[model samples]
Target: MSKTSQDEWTLEIKPVSGWFHFHLKDVWRYRDLLMMFVRRDFVAVYKQTILGPFWFFLQPILTTITFTVVFGNIARISTDGIPPLLFYMSGIVSWGYFSDCLTRTSSTFITNANIFGKVYFPRLVSPLSNIISLLMKFGIQLFLFTCFLLYYWMNGSTNVHPNIYILLTPYLLILMAGLGLGFGIIVSSLTTKYRDFSFLVGFGVQLLMYATPVIYPLSALPEKYKWIVLANPMTAIIDTFRYAFLGAGTFNPGNLIYSSVFMIVTLSIGILMFNRVEKTFMDTV
Candidate 1:
C-alpha cells in the first residue's frame, strides 16, 4: 500500500511545559491560522450587523445605562456616592471582559473540534488566539468606559482619583484572561462527555453577573452573602478594576490572594485536562 501526499505528511504536535510548556514555537508556527481565526471571530461575529465594532462598545454602554436606570436610579443602589454611571461602568467593563473570555474559552472544544481533528497545532493556540481577539474587543469597550471615566473625573465625582492600585491594571487584565480560560477549559472538557454545558453557559453567565458585583457594590451585599459573592474570582478582579479606576472598591489583600490562588490552581488543572482531552475529545465530542 502506498500513502498519498496528505497521508505521508504527519502531524507532529507535542506537549511541552515549564514556563515554556505551551510550546510557543509551535504556536508561532501556526500564527497565520491564529490571525485567520481572529479575523473570522471579528468579521463573522457581526457580519450582518450595521454597527460592527461600535456594537461592541454599545453592549457595555447599554448595560451601564440600564443598570443606572433600573438598579441605580430606580432601586437606588449605593455607589459610595460616586456617580451612578461611573460605578456601573466600572463593573460593566470588568464583567464584560471576564464574561467574554469565559464564554469564548468555554466553547473552544465544541466550536473548533473540526479544526482540531483535521490539523495538529499547539492546542493552546486556539484559546490563546481567542484570548488575544477577545482583548481587542475589550480594548474597544474600555475606550467607551474611559469616556465616561473622564467625564466623571472632571465632574469631581466621589473624590476619586486614580491611585497606586491603578498601576495593577495589567494584572487585572491577566486575571480576567486566566480565569476565563481556566473556567472555560474545565467546562469545555466536561461538555465533551455531558453536553448540558452549552445550555448552562448562556443562562449561567447571566446569572453569574448578578451573583457578581457587576451592577451592585460588594458593600451593599448582606453580611452573610458577601462571603459567598466575593468567593468568585471575578469578584476580586472586578473590585480591583473599579478600585483602580474610581479609587474605591472592596479589594482586600486577602481577596486578591484568594483570586490569584484560585486562578493558578484552575489554570494548571485546565492545561492538564485540556492536554488529556486533546488526545481523545473528538472521539466523545
Candidate 2:
C-alpha cells in the first residue's frame, strides 16, 4: 500500500493517563453503540412481561398509594398542606428517576463484565446509556404526575398552587441526573474491588430517601436540624420540585446553587474515579 493509504488504515491505541482523562471524544464517536445500549436497556426489562412498558406508570402509582396510606394516613406526616396524593407522587417521581439512574449505573462494570472483557469501546457508554434509557422511564412517570397535577390544579378543593418556579423542572432533572450519575459511577468503581458495595447500594439509597424529604416536606422538619437535610444535595432537588409544581416546599435559589455546585464537584470527582478505575476494573471485577 502507498504511505497515504497505509495511514488511512492505521489505528492508534494509547494508555490513558491522569485522573480526569475520560475519553469523552471516544464516547461521542460511539454514539451509535450508546443508542443500541439504550434501546436494549429500555426494551429488555419488559420484553418478557405481559404489561411491558405499562410498568413504568404502575410502579410510581403503586408507590405513591403506599406512601399515602403509610405516611399520610397512618403516620400522619404533614405534606405541607398539599394533598397527600400530589405530594407523594411528586417526590416519588423525582426520587425514582434519580434512584433508577444511580442503581443501574452503579452496576455498569459488573453487569457488563463479559462485554467489557471483549470490547474495545469506551466503557462509559454502558452507564451513559443507562442514564438515557432511564430518562424515557422518567418521562413516562412525569406524564403520569402531570395528569394528577392537572386534576388537582383545576380543582379548588385541592388548592394546589403551581407557580412560575415550575420552569425549573428541566433544571431539576439535570441536577438529578448529575447527582445520580456522579454517585453511581463512584459506587460502581468501588464495587469493582469490594463486592460489599454492591449490597450496600440498595439499602443506602433507601435510607438516603428518608433523609431527603420525599415522604414529608422540609417545612415539617424540625427547625434546628433542617440544615442537616439541606446538606444533602438531593434535598434541594426534591424541595424545588415540590415548590415548583405543588407550591408547598422550600425553594431557595441558594439551595439550588448549592446543589449545582455539589453536582459539579461530585461529577468531576466521579469522572476522575471512573476514568482511573475503568483501566483496571476487569481485574478486580
Best by lDDT: 2
Model 2 per-residue lDDT at 241: 94
Candidate 2's residue-wise lDDT over 134-208, tens digit each? 999999999999999998787774658888998999999999999999999999999999989989998999999
187: Cα error in model 2, Å: 0.6
Per-model TM-score on C-alpha atoms = 0.87, 0.94
> What digit string (tens of lDDT, one per residue) describes model 1 on residues 42-161?
778888789877788788888889999999889998887678888898888878888888888888889888888898777777887788898888888788878878887787665676
User: How accurate locally, in lDDT, is each candidate?
Assistant: 0.82, 0.91
lDDT for 108 (candidate 1): 85
| Residue 151 CA displacement from its true place in model 2, Å | 1.2
